[model samples]
Target: MELQQMRYVVAIAETNSFTRAAERCLVAQSALSHQIARLERELGAKLFERTSRRVRLTPAGAAFLPAARQCLDAAERAAAQAAAAVGEVRGRLAVGLIPTVAAVDVPGALRDFRQKYPHVRIGLCVGASDDLVEQVREGALEVAFLGLPTTVVPKGVNTYELARDRHVAVVAPDHPLAEESTVDLRRLSAEVFVDMPAGTAGRIQSDLAFSAAGLSRDVAFEVTSADYMARLVGEGLGIALLPSAYVPRLTGVTTIEVIDAPSRAEYVIWSRTVCTPAASAFLAILGISTGPGTPDRGPVPGSSVRVAAE
Candidate 1:
């Protein structure tokens, strides 16, 4: 029932090790176990199934975990709200970024945010769009810049469209398709495609576009980094479909607009939970409203128009 007990349960569930959880909670192993036992007794069910090698949550624990996190988040938000009431925006803010987030001048934004709130700490996490979305959903990150499909938005999250850029084709400068101002997706169906690993926003869009066009690309090289993909294309390894912003300015590579390619939409997404002061300040800098009832600013001037998702 105690908030500290909820904290212990969450920590133990996340780490899956009572020892590590105790370390994370900055408490002794025995005392942490004692508190958890008390909680289980009060609830009349065991929360964790402990073994010599590992600690895992029981079904009861699994059901209780999300509620525990919600309680903790509510408490944290209450504290943050009290601090915000005094016009203070000083706290740690965890922000997530996907690899293809080029539309937002992240460095410039961070610099301005730091200048305005000198005491607020910023932590940056970079990952694939799906991973970043999941992190935001799980409360691991306060906000994330995600490259999502135009038609689909995750549930229980608020998203503000930041920018949308068309997917383009990149190839070696000497490649035949490089000279063309715009090439059709069917023309490159036979060409070797260098792409990010499956499940990435760009890759998913590319796959869907090709499928929609009744074409299949020969994916010869799969890389996780945009820079590496550009390098691979520069070396004549293969061609790649990438967000225009992610195409590197490399000497041997040439970027061409794809005639019928799908566009990827970039969004700043966060859970609908109460906003932290730092998150609010960052959103304000991006010209977004942080109110709960605020609607999505579909596409602003200077932002690329998004195509319907395939």
Candidate 2:
């Protein structure tokens, strides 16, 4: 399985059209089809099911897709390591974060990273802490920002603690508790709440807090976006408990300090297995160690770039 053949297969699988995939690969439709046919002949299985109207991966293709992508990533990483060995950084830096990230300015961080390594490509993903951690563990993301209850630490990824803060109550401007300067878990528990989906890391922080306080709160609205949750709270749907640093920015809501609040810790996590040079450089900006051999501010004048991956 040549990388180009695999690339054609991946592009076709993603676009679900031979014509579009050929366009994406910058090759002719017949040439792309010939390659796929050759790949199928070598693998002894059809990779895709082509119909008059649509294209879909066959069972064999489903099994091969993930490994194919992994191969492509590994190949790219190998090239990046070689470049890093010679005072240059070139690779995609995929980053993931939750919407509530507050410890470091993401755009600013990317700006600084770009200024230093213009050759490196950057990508961003916004997701829940749990999901982001999983992405980092899978090497789908080079780094991720997470927020979880202080009691819980991510299981598989390498992490660096950024900061910690208590949860605050968000109530609509016209709600009865809007004027309150401080509240407790028990008090907040008495009211309905708007929160992230149950069982999520973000929701669990508040859940654990109230559960420990022997209080049960009703989560009347389950939303994925924090901004949308704040909108629901603004409409008096329910109150919410969010990290103190994030609630201040929500319009049409009053933030009350939670006297007996749940505290959450922010973490920056990266793949324990593959720490690319670009990733290490980004981490270094935050003073986060990328194990050994991490690149410094930029490429060294006369030295090869440091390869920090374990």
Give RMSD to native, each candidate: 4.6, 5.6
- Candidate 1 lDDT, 146-174, residue by residue in tens: 88767767567788876667888889999
Instruction: Write model 2 residue lDDT over 93-186, tens digit each, in one string.
Output: 9999999887667787788789999999999999999889888888889999888888888888777766777888999999999888888887
| Weakest 10 consecutive residues of candidate 2 by summed lDDT | 301-310
Off by over 4 Å in 1: 90-92, 118-123, 127-141, 149-156, 173-182, 196-200, 208-214, 221-225, 249-252, 259-261, 292-310
All candidates' TM-scores? 0.76, 0.91
Query: Clash pairs of candidate 1?
Result: none
Cα error, candidate 1, residue 102 (Å): 1.2
Tell me the spans in candidate 2 whose CA falls farther than 4 Å from its real position: 292-310
Query: Looking at candidate 2, what is the lDDT of residue 139?
Result: 87
Clashing pairs in 2: 87-305
Most lDDT-accurate candidate: 2
